[model samples]
Target: MSSIAFMTQAQEYMFTYSKLFSHLKQNVKQGHEDVKVGLFFLNADTKKNCVIQKAWMEKEQHYEELKTTRYNELLLPLDDNLKSANPLVFVRTPQDQRCDFSMVVMTKQPLKGTVSYTEVEMLLPQMQVMLEDLGGMFASWFTPDVEGVTLEFQGLVDGQVEFSNGKTKPIVNGKAQVALSDIGQGGSMILPQETSRVLPYLPRAD
Candidate 1:
């Protein structure tokens, strides 16, 4: 039988908040209000398991790391909240699936002085609930695709292969295939070397 398999390869995906920043800046300017920025994995199923590799703010030649209090959350520093900084997050999901991350830039009442860790910890539960509620409103504020090359395979038999997103697939017949929607870029799927040979072909739309 001929099949196409997806092999896991630890792919890196980036989440950015350029549009969210613009929206928040305008709101802050008009209302003369302080705003807080946060990043969250809104999907209940994958939020906890998702691994955040790194996060940072970028503007021209300057880049600074953004600290995370938990695996699922990253609250922006209050000193220069969103000023001209573009936030970027590098993450790896446990498996190849739809990305459900959200960027939340909400108006916040100003707090005096610096915020301590204890205060932040206490506020986390409320923040989580609020962010999740706002997620759907700003769903289009960022692009939700994983960056990587796509490959295809052919002339394979029943077996299993790993995927870049850390998920494995079992090839039932020589015809198991990965859906195009599951993969952003167009190309073919990658298969294990020992199982079968693959042929490269033009990508087709789902």
Candidate 2:
């Protein structure tokens, strides 16, 4: 095959691989959230699980007490009694799907404060209930056709959610949008050059 033909074939294979893995990651994160809430309702140690997850995500100084403290302050209680509370939404772009991305917006009021372990422990049930209710209610809105990128806007206003597909005008839904540059800013993941590792999962045409 000509060099151009080879390059095109390799690029196609990589796209396929990216789609496959992206879908897998989305499924896993969504499924895991469901399982965590279910377990929490069943009196499982869901808070500890959250801590462990935070540690993994940070992947640096997992033993740092300050990080743990902040994590707890930012997420706990799950009630409206918080002094200062804000929406904590998690959005992730899928590998291969019709929709641009998937997101989980936790309860309208996510707890925020420094509390004793026992206090947080006492509030676990409320937190779990809120999470379950919020997740179940918003499940439909996050399905595969919601194409657009969400961004967080904290300007003169309290906070704003900016939505855009990078073509038409941005849509403001009065909520903070999750800015996923890799998806919203298209062509962010393009490979600079062809390589032998492009078709690892399939037979090579070359």
- Report every candidate's CA lDDT: 0.40, 0.23
Provide the lDDT at 72 for model 1: 44
Q: Give the local distance difference test score of model 1.
A: 0.40
> Over all chains combined, what TM-score does candidate 1 have?
0.31
lDDT of 2 by residue, 1-206 (tens): 00111122212111122222222233234333321221110003211212212311112232211122322212222223221222222211122211211123222223222212232233333333433444456643442322222222212123322223332223232222222332243222111121101100111112
**TM-score of decoy 2:** 0.19
Q: How much is 115 displaced in model 1, in angstroms?
A: 23
Worst 10 residues of 2 by lDDT: 195-204
lDDT value for model 2? 0.23
Q: Write the per-residue lDDT of candidate 1 for residues 89-184, one digit (tens) a residue.
A: 344445554445555533243222322324323333333333333445563343232112122223444565444445555665443343333322
After superposition, which runs of candidate 2 have C-alpha atoms over 4 Å from their true positions?
1-74, 77-144, 156-206
Can you give the TM-score per candidate against the true fold?
Answer: 0.31, 0.19
